[model samples]
Target chain A: MVSDNFFPQPGGVESHMYQLASKLIDRGHKVIIITHAYPGRTGVRYLTNGIKTYHVPFWTIYRETTFPTVFSFFPIFRNIVIRERIEIVHGHASLSNLCHEAILHARTMGMRTVFTDHSLFGFGEAGSILTNKLLKFTLSDVDHCICVSHTCKENCVLRASLDPSMVSVIPNAVVADNFRPLSQNEIDSRRSSAPGPPQPLGPNDTITIVVISRLFYNKGIDLLIAAIPRILASQPNVRFIVAGSGPKAIDFEQMVERNVLQDRVSLLGPVRHDEVRDVMVQGHIYLNPSLMEAFGTVIVEAASCGLYVVCTRVGGVPEVLPSHMTEFAAPEEDDLVAATNRAVAKLRSGKVRTDLFHNQVKQMYSWTDVAQRTERVYDSISTTRSFALIDRLKRYYGCGIWAGKLFCMCAVVDYLLFIFLEIFAPRERIDVCKDWPKKAVPVAKLGEEEDVESLKEGGVPGRKRNSRHRREKRDETDESSAA
Target chain B: MTTLITILTRLASPPPQTLHTHQPTSSTVTYTVTTRPALTGLCAKLGFYVGISARVVLGMVAVLVVCLKWCVSLGIGISVLGAFWGEGGERGMRRIMKLIEITDGTYIIPLAILVLFLACKRNYKEESLTIISGLGLQTSTTSSFYLRSPSTRFISTTAIQDIFIHEAFKGFEVRFYLAVVVEGEREVVVVFPSMLPRRGILEEVWREGRKCLWEMGEKG
Candidate 1:
């Protein structure tokens, strides 16, 4: 797998890649990641579930995406591909220059390529136009394109002018074990400590609505700022826990102060991705007023934690969960306020079975299921004969009247470059690296054990399995270097 | 910008007649001015031409005359607005420009470039990548790219290696522009300065160079 967004940088794409890679590794596939180096996380490293990641040192331009110097990545990328003996080079996130470069190089090396589009982009903005053209060029001959939702698929098709059949809608999955609701034992312990049966508040108990996302304009923080005061004024029992930090965070803080509702709104700042569930379970409702989203994985995570969701109807948020699991709102402030009001009423009436949400969400989305589907994509691509050089060029040629020809020329040159490289550095000279140790258990057993382990370790501050493993590995490597 | 605002609001806002109550005419019979469907279609076609006329005219000027690209782009933009949306063509051109601006910047410039690049496909001995490729290549300790022939030496970067692909693109024609690979004090700089039509070819060459990288990688 290749991407620019990865660990040390907390984001949707980063988490998606990590979770997917780990899940794929659990399914007995030797998954490795190739991403640009991040601060203090350079060179090769091992992540949880025995997933190896190579952080190639490159100059990051924006948002951790490296500057796209097309052919410059060839040498290092070629090294990594050869070392791992990668067959199918799956790339994630459309905005990643590393992903595009990897796909182009993988195809040149006669490897199958898959690209996953994680975000929705419109064709209007100058940035979008340039991105779409670049996307068109890269996706022109990609074996297949995976989109997080049907809406994303439609957007990708329109932007790249690709055939509908080539694009598949695979919704992102949340690890239900990590996002489980408060267990009965925990609730019992809490009741014993507080000496009251979890206060089914009569008429006026505070209902905490949680908003956990980067406070960015595209996230509809403006709409959230507009609606928060109104929602508070209308519903006396509601308070808020807004946990995230972004450029728009100050705006939210300002709104809370301006409305003098600072007491009602609690800003937790930026919480780690793993601690999101902890923040989520404290709330009665999850408020997502994002103006745009591709899959809205956080909503799924919220539902898994047993919070009633109130989100705007945009991008693929509508299709993520059932209408019963959520209250839909338009992007407008008035509509959001109205939606929040409805959710607050639903909570008061006890119409939503929040307790049953954890189990339902578990059944709906699982990393194992996602991994299985991805394996099928790999199976299909491997079984089918790879597109011939001429065939690939022809496909690229249909991109645009001029773009088609340009792409064709690119493909032809890439093919020639491949031939030249074959003569210079033969495949026989490269050494295949040994694979990481695989568990002896069956794939199904491994998956089930992973879920059980994750569940057992939930909310345990000192368990720190992932961090511990990373620390141990780093220490061992450090000692070895000293020797 | 004000005209843009008015036209946009006029199109989006409710029709003016909808606001007022209708009064019966004194005349016993009403006369209707009918427009033919074909005539309307013809007008729409004419409007489309007018809408795209700016792009077409600008493109012609760019291809026929060699000048600063941005000046041509700006000049043609102004001329198109004046010539196609003059007093006579205002109504139709307004609708076209409105649609263009809203949907996409008329896509005039990009579409024009695409056409020019495609049309200007010529056989050249050497294709060049531009200085922009210098962006990230400076950090790499050892970076190499392919050109047309395997023997074509790239200067300014440490020692370079070549793989001859005989009969590939009838002899591959790719050049890298300022692709720097730093090793200690010495650096390997691969420079390919792509001219107009050659720019497109250079991009193609860059895309094609991946194969060379892959092969040389396998040879390692």
Candidate 2:
């Protein structure tokens, strides 16, 4: 996986990469991550489950995104690709400069490339125009593209002008075990225990609505600020627990102070990823008033934590959760207020069966299912013939009048640089690294272990036998020398 | 002299290191020459000097143009020249011309030469790992310039701990290097710090060095 976002930096893409890579490793595929080095985190490090990561040193310009020095990353990237014997270069995130460069260089080196678009872009803004141009350049010749949702796929297809068949919709999944709701036994014990805070809400009890998103303008924080006071005023039994911090947080604070609703509104600034479940279980309703989203993995997580989701109907948010579990609203203050009231009424009336949401969500989305789908993508791309230089240039030339020629020139120059590297730093001289020792799958996961064994049997018989024979011969030599 | 083996390897940079193993008398001397002959031909040196001179001249001309355009008006330019040639005229003009010539030759030319020299210079001319049977290990680095003496350390057979090839992150990528862990030292001494050859070369060195050290240990 190649991306600018990875672990130690928390975001949807980072967790998505981690989960997918680890799950792919579980399916007997050797996975490695290539990302720019974070502060004090340069070098090759091994994450859990033997996923080797090469943190290439890079200059980060803003918000952990590397400066787009197109050709400068080629040498080091080529070295890593050669050393790892990488067959497929999978790039993630449209905003990542490293991902774009890797996709270009991988194509130059005649390797199959896959790109995943995680966010949606509009065709109207200048920033989006530039980003769309870049997306067109990189996705012009990519083997296949993956988007987090159907809406995201359409947006990416429109932005890059890609064939709909070449793009697949693979939703991001939450680790269900991590986002599990409070069990009935735990809830009952909390309620029956002496002198403790109320655990379960009565019919007339104060319903705590949870809002856990970065308070930004695009997140519809202004609508949230407007809706909060009205929701509290109309529904005397409703309160709010807001988490996350951003520029618009001051607006929320001012709104709360202006309304004298300090006792009802509690602000928990910037909760970590692991603590999201604990916060989610405290509320009966989860509110996500974002202006736009690609997948909205957080709502699935909220539903898994047994909270009824009240979200804006924008981008891909409507497609994420089932209608029964979610209350959708337009991106307006009054609509959001109505949605939250509806959710609160449903919760009070005991009409929504939130207690069973965890199991249903687990059945609906899983990393295992995502990994299987991604493997199918990899399998399909592996068989598809890669385009030659001329064909690739032709495709690039169809992007725009001026951009087409510019992209063609860039591809031609990248190909020349590849040829230069191949001649000067010959591939024979670059040493292939030994793979990290694979851990034996625990007996608890016997089904997966058997599946992997079967996959090995069905996949590359000669290479597997050759490596085993080499190991046996080495052992024999060691034994002979000992004797 | 009987040469046992020779290995040639290149680093990320252009210059290649050639490792030579000599089995003379009872000792094994394995040394690598890291310094390639600097700017070999006279034509190359002349070309480099000419290029530097052209760059310096062009830079001076650009600076003069920019100064004339932005820093000084045409009247000031002529007045400055007039001041140089007008008052205390001949002697001052001659002295200023001499100062310019001296500055050109002494300052800029030598600075360029120093840069060329530094670019061509290596910290160590050669590094060697010697194993005399029953006498432990000896590693030395010969200085490229005469300003610093060669650094040599001999680990007695008893003090020698272990020699192995290890992988480390150098700059942007992971690299393989050979290191010697002394008996009591906190840090292991890297064998070749400057020219870190590939893993194949490092593995060969590790195997041969360990065999020489341990085989002799058993014999003695």
Candidate 3:
């Protein structure tokens, strides 16, 4: 699969790409990655699971969308496609110009293409318009599409005018074991013998509500600003612990000053993902008032950390958690305030089993499950590749009157390129790389044991897996998958 | 209010309509004539334009008059006023104002350039809904200026789309602009810069094909 987004960049899309790639490798696909060059990175670097990444040299114009020199990329990309013998060209992220250009060139070079969407975009805004247009141009001829969630699928359909059927709803998953909740013994030892698990807060205990996302407008920092003063005024004992920073940092500071909440609301700035468990364990509630979300990984992380979640019911947030663990509110200032109040009250009353949320959330998501679902998409598309041609034509047909025709022309061009490749430079000319050590069979069995193990783990079990048998089996799986 | 009280009540208080001497409307002619719908189809036209025109027309014109005197009012007009008129809203008012401003800019800018060579010894005489080229005075959505000439009525035809679309070399594009004339019906204004063969020449051909659109309001 070809993508311009990979490791080093720290974002939801970036993480999604890395995890999905590694998992694909585990499943025994001879997965090689292609991305624009990062500052320090160049050439092919094999990541943990022998996943080869090709960092192509390209102009890094505005926020890493490679300078769109359309035909400039075709020569080098064709060389890579010839070298790797990539049958599938899969691109990730909407804003990546490299991804879009790669899709265009890959189509010209004749390869099946898949695009994975990670964020939700509105029909409004110039950025989305530009993206939608570019997306329309790229997706107009691509084979299949995957989105992190149903909302994201709807957004892709409406944005690029793809058929809902052509686009699969494959929600993003966390390595559930990685996000395990802290055990009572671990918490007690870590808290310096904090007197019997800190005793579920008396009516007077300072309820520390935590916020860990970067404080940006879409993260609903504006709502945070407007709601903070009122919340503090009414709920005196309620304190806030805010982590992460962005343009809204100054606004958050000013709010703290204006309301004299200097002592009440603590701003811890940015925290690393690994340190998230430490930050989260300090608060009774995790507040996620994100204005829009494709899949709220942080809320899941927060729930996994044994914190009752108070989040806005926007984008894919409502679908991520069951109602019992989350206090869902409309993306409104008053609604958020009321929801936070309800969460704090629930926490104070000891009616919520936030302690049990970690195990529950772990069962719902995993990188393995995501990889399995993705494998199905690959099979379905590759197996029915012929009839899927008409399905693609119809999808491109719906893009728009002019755009529809333009898209069909692109698809036809791609088909012609496929024919060209078949005649000259041929599949025989391309040399396939040997597979790296794969997930051991014993590890596969252990993964299957997650259903039972997750329950007994009680959230935090520092059980890391390593087995020789699984690695050998993983290699066999890759050989078969490629064949 | 105190000036009115001093003028009318002398020393006693209460600013009232009767006792005041220096009439606020003294210099202004009070035309109480409710403008009858003079043109047959004009009533509907007026109605269509009212939500947009009420600020520059209805409120001042229902008690219609050509004000012999003019003063600049600094306020959020039509939009805020629309709330009082009990019709549409700030949206229609803004649409009307924006249209008027755009038309004035597009035409007047060229006209003003043409006028600079004219030997009129006028103090930058400007007109309402007037078309002129630049050089003597400047105007646009971000700018408003009086010609040394005293023309009150202003119209601007600011084809901003033309300016931006001219530079774009790659990718498919659509440019939309709307024109509302004080004298004519509102219409959309468009300009196609060039044709992209891979993208297509349809929008370009349509652009060159439609000359009547450049002339005046005949909808496509």
Candidate 4:
């Protein structure tokens, strides 16, 4: 996978790539990630799960995305591809210049490429217009496209004008282990074998609505600021635990001060991703007032933590969870306040099965399922015939009136550059690195024969290896399926 | 300098107006000034100042530095060219002098024509809108010493459909007025208030303006 966002920069994309790559490795696939150098994090590094990562040195201009030095990345990229003997190149995030450049180069080198779009962008903005054109250019020759949500798939298809069938809807998954709720045994021990079982809520008990997101304008901080005072005034036993900080945090603090809600509202400035579950479990409802989102992974994490979600119905959020787990609201102050009120009332009435939410969410999404689906995409691409240069050129020719011609010229130039490199640095001269030992999938007959031999003989190391592999696989399945 | 000022004054000489019986409290006026400072503004990194006095002096110094830098760079370029041509020795200097003497007339006509062309062009006019109490609004503009009489267009507060207050970067505030008549005619009004020495004053004006428009609805 090639992306600008990776480890050491904590974000949704970074977490998604890490989780997906690790799960893919577990499923018996050798995965490597290529990214631009981050501060103090340059050179090759091996992450957990033995996933190789190559951090190439490049100049980053904004938001950690390297400046678009298109042709400059080709030499190093070609060397990595040759050395690794990679058959497919998977790129993530639309705004990543490295991903776009790698996709172009990978196609030039006659390899199957897949692009995963993680966010939504409106065509009305000038920046979006330019980015959409670039997306159209890159995705023109790509084998398949993956989107985190169905809405995102629609958005990607529309933006790139790709065939709908080629675009797949693969939602982002949260690791259930990391976001687990309080177990029954723990709850029982804490409450001294707990009175009855556990009530979701009581009338007199304060309902802490948790909000953990960057306090930015598009995150609907304005709507949040407008609704907080009214929500407090209307609901007497409701409090808020706001985590994460941004430019709009001051606005929130000012609103809290103006409404004199310091006692009721606790601001835990910024919390790490791992600490999110700890903060989330402290609340009964997770309030997400974001105006725009592709797939709200935090809400799924919240649900996994057994917190009822209250989020604005915008940009794939509604499709993320079932109605039972979430209360949807329009992107407005009145609607958000009403939604919170509804969630609070439901919590008070003990109607929502929040305790059972963890198990239900675990069944809904898993990294194993995502990796399996991604593998299917890879399998399909290998069987399909590779597109001719003219066919690829034809796809790019339909991007825009002038953009079409410009893109075709770029493609032609890139193809020529690839041919020149092929002649100059003949592929035969490059040395392929030895692959790591593969846990081969043995046939049933061979396994049976081996089992008999192991029983006849004293012991076999292959028997131990087979048993250990099966145990690890069983453990993974058990942990993933466990609530 | 005297001739430049005279030309500036002549250029701003206002056109004759048909006097009306009703005089408005607020009016708009236009005039011209030298375009040299604006060109200097483009050359320098000096931002447009609203009201702070200290910033104006700093801006002037920055523009002056840019002007001096350009002059010094040009002098160095000419000296370097002269040094390269010094292989011809003293004879090269004499030849250049003769060449200049011969080309002086040829350069004068084009320079004169260019100056005349530039003089015909008017300097940019800066527009300001002032909110007058018990009246609609007044607009005015000044260039050099010439102050042209402003013309006002009265608008009833009842006509205002909506008022939008936009706070730009660095405390700059802009107000947009959307007005619609009962007959379905639409009118738009844009206003930019002077940046005060202190913050919050523009926001105060915005609130007051919004209040006035809303109160007009009650009166209507």
Candidate 5:
């Protein structure tokens, strides 16, 4: 997997890459991550579950996105590809420079390339226009594309002009175990354990609403600021806990001060992903005022934490949860206020069975299910024949009148660079890395051994010794699996 | 103990720089043993001196131009200010010429020679790694000048925990290195850290170094 966004940077795409990689590893697939280096974190490092990350040092120009140097990354990327004997180069995030470059190079090198678009983009903006053209160039030769939701798929298809069948909708999932709701005993113990001024909510008590999004304009921080004052005014027994920080945070702070709602509103600035549930469980309602979202994974997380969700009806948000779990509102101040009030009323009446939400969400989305679906996508693409160079050029030519030719030129240059590298740094000169010892696959799960065999058939010639070692460990693995 | 093998190879960097893997005894190996500094040859020394002189001359000329430009500007400013006080411009021009003479007369040649000497102080000598049977490994980089001793580190045989060929990211590219994991040290001691030969060379050195360090003891 290749992306600019990966841990220890937190976001939807980062967690998506990590969870999917780990789950794929659990399914007995070799997975490694390629990301640009973060400060104090460079070189090769191993994460949980033996996922090796090559933090390739690159210049980051904006917001953790690596500066786009088109062919400069080819040598190192090619070295990594050869070292890992990688068959499929899975790239994530549309905006990631490393992903786009990897996709272009992977296609040039005759390796299967897969791209996952994590966010939605509009075609009207100038930035989106440029991004859309670039996306079209990369997706023109991509083996398959994955989007987090059907809305995202449609948006991506329209923006990139890709064939509908080539795109698959695989929703992002949360680790439900990490976002579990506090048990009744745990909540009672906490209330009795700490003698704080704030107490646990009883029937007809003050309703605590939670807002946990980064305070950016697109996240609807202004709408949140406007709705909070009115929501508190209309609902006398309501409190707000906003738990993120950004440029719009000062606006939120001023809203709290101007309304003199300091006692009721608490701002827990910039909570980590792991601590999200702890904040969620303290509230009766979860408010998401995002102006645009590809797939609102956090609302599902809030639902999993047993908080009744109040979200704006924006891109991919309505399709995430059922009507019973959330109260949807148009992205406006009054509607949000009304929605929060309605959710608060429901929580007061005890009509929503939030206690069962965790189980329902657990059944709704899972990384295992996502990995299985993604594996099917991989299997389908593996069976289909890849495009020839001429065919790839033709596809690039169809992107647009001017951009098409420019893209073809880029592909030609990238191909020439590949040829040059083949002569300059031959494959034999590069060392093949030792594979991480895989977890034992159970006998029942070995039904898809054909894929593994096919991958091994495409492995590097230098990997014979490692394969022999694996063969020797087969019996040990079987014993462990059997036990 | 007797001599086992000797493989003479070139460093991966460039030509004329060589690496020698010599096992004088059965359980000892010395690599990259250069008898003279890289700049010791007559032509190389002449070329080095010429390059340094040219750079120093260019630097001095650049300094002269900059200083002259500054003095001209300062002289003009002083003359303009002096004219307001009924002082003559000849005095300012004389002062600027004296300042120029002070800079150009005494300090330029000595400063240039000092800079040249300092530039020659860089280590243009080869680095070597030596391993003996019971005594551990010693890594050294020879200094170009005799005034400074070579920087060397010796890890005792017992303290030498492990040796392996590893690859890591350096700058924008991946490089192969032979690293020694010394006991109780957090960072591995990188053998041939500066030269950073290719994987083939590092693997050979790793195999030979390990055999000389530990495997021969086991066989005995």
Candidate 6:
């Protein structure tokens, strides 16, 4: 598996990639990640779980998205794909140019490809148009596509114009046990234990609202800034703890100053993910004023921390948490203020059972569940499509008018490159990296053996080595009923 | 120059860099100001207090956001209202929106080439909007940075330089209200606010601009 987002980047997509990759590796699938060089990071590095990662040096255009150099990534990528004898290429993160380039090159090389879109994009902006087109071009010939949520699948089908059948809806899973909410007794003891923490509020104490996200425009920093003053003015015994940093940082700061919320609102700036729980435990409400999302895992994380959620009703946010845990607000300034007020009122009135959110959230997600779902995706691709690269191209060719033709052309060029590389950069000549001491999947006896035999020909890259768990191999073969 | 870079470098993180630890010695009830430097703002404090339309405010903010996000220079100047000189929303009054549209349009190489095709053409058809008696860009002389709040989030909006387009061409002669297409796409409105118009043609000229825009959209 190849992915662009990994550890170091603090976002939902980044976390999803890390969790999925780690889980896949634990399932005995050899996963190698390919991402652009991040600050202070260079060359190939092995993450803790023996997962190898290659960070290619590339110029960053906006945020961490690499400058799109379409054909430039081909030569090096071809070398890696060939060296690994990779039969399948899996790309992650929609914004990563590296991921797009790999998918394009992999398709060109006649390898089965899977693309995972972690974020949802709207059809409205010009930026979305270009992004969607680029997405269309890459996905035009890919073998299969994966989306974090059903909403994201719909978005991908519309944007890339792919058939819904080929796109799998695999929601991102959170490491639920990590976020355990404090109990009332625990909260009181902790407050007392702290030698005088903000004493546990007896229903009338100040309610703390937490906002944690990058201060970018798309994150709706403008809405956050606009609503802060209104939220503070309406509720006197309310305090804000905003932890983020971006271009909108100044805008939020200005709001704080204009309202003289110096004592009331505290900007904690950016914080690490591990510390999110600690900061969240201090707050009663979690406010997410994001403009768009594919799967709002942060809201899940917030709910897991037992904070009542107040979020803009855009993208997939409305579907993330049940109404009991969250209050939905339209993506409008007035609506957001009103929703926040409602959430505060609900908290004061004891109507919202926020204390029960932690256990509920833990039940909703797990890395193991995500791994099993991903395994199903791999099964569907290999079992359903028969390693037939042409059939995969046929799936991609259904993308759109000009996009379909362009994708076929990309696939043809990649096939030609594969033949050329076979002649010049012979696979026999390149050294195959040894597997990291993983147990082999013993070919199961009986009818299950025939299915595994068929999969061997169309196996995912690094899958040929060994299936460490015979249980998973048996469980996956029984896959027709998977959701 | 050093201060500018420092200010920019600081923009990456949110306000209040040093997190307050919940310690016994810490002032839990009383809030103290963070040690962040109170560097002069890129705009005046009172500027953001009053309401400014997206057209005006976004234009001024674009000078920085674009420079940071796109790594390009954009010159935005706004002046008071005057007579229409045919540039219409594309140039004078809606400079911010126009600039965004143009930049977004030109950002793609294919669209850039398309725009280049329009730029090369010499003479073209011209249509008229309402021959306004007076209409101009709400232009303002650019102000240097002043009184910037240190604990701000997102973009530090600079003081607005409103460029108003006068309604000079709002009531004008039919003949003077000419719509000329430059290159392949751009339509320029060249009526001057200072230019005298023929009597009783104002309403006709006003009607023509809308018709022209509608016609262009249909043709496009």
Clashes of each: 29, 0, 41, 3, 0, 73
**CAPRI rating of model 6:** incorrect
Q: Where does candidate 2 chain B have its weakest 10-residue lDDT segment?
A: B1-10
Candidate 2 achieves a global lDDT of: 0.79
Q: Which candidate would rank higher by TM-score, 1 or 6?
A: 1
Tell how far residue B206 is off in model 4, in angstroms: 76
The regions of model 5 sitting more than 4 angstroms off are A191-203, A439-483, B1-128, B133-135, B140-152, B156-165, B170-172, B181-188, B194-220
Instruction: Say which docking band candidate 4 falls in.
Output: incorrect
Per-residue lDDT value at A148 in model 3: 80
Candidate 3 chain A least-lDDT 10 residues: A460-469
Off by over 4 Å in 2: A193-201, A439-483, B1-125, B128-139, B146-148, B152-174, B178-189, B204-220
Best by DockQ: 5
* lDDT (10s digit) by residue, model 1, range B112-184: 5676654443222222321111121111111122122322333322222221110000011211122323333
Q: Evaluate every candidate with DockQ and list the scores.
A: 0.01, 0.11, 0.00, 0.00, 0.13, 0.00
Candidate-wise lDDT, in order: 0.69, 0.79, 0.62, 0.72, 0.80, 0.63
Give the TM-score comparing model 5 with the true structure, all chains together: 0.75
Q: Report chain A TM-scores, every model.
A: 0.89, 0.90, 0.83, 0.89, 0.89, 0.84
| Positional deviation of residue A235's Cα in model 3 after best superposition, in angstroms | 1.9
Which parts of model 4 have CA positions greater than 4 angstroms off? A185-195, A439-483, B1-220
Can you write out model 6's per-residue Cα lDDT over A1-483, one digit (the tens) per residue? Answer: 655565456677767776777798889787777787676555544443545666777778887888887766776677666555677788888788888888877766666789999888888899899899889877766778998877888889999888788898878878877777876677677555554433434566789999889899888989888888988888888999999788889988888888788998899988877788888888899999999888888889899988999998877677777888989989999999999999998888777777788888888888888888888777777654443567757865776688777767766776676655555444443334434435334533332354333423333221211232223333433342363
DockQ of 1: 0.01
- Local error of candidate 2 at residue A314 (angstroms): 1.2
Better of 4 and 5 by lDDT: 5
Error of 5 at A423 (Å): 1.3
Candidate 5 lDDT, B1-220, residue by residue in tens: 1121111111222323456787788888899844334666799899878976776676665555454545455666444434544645677666755665456534655665565566445435578999888878899887775357878999998897667665688754677677777777767798877777766566667656766788788887
With candidate 6 superimposed using the best TM-score fit, by how many Å does residue B29's alpha carbon deviate from the native?
74
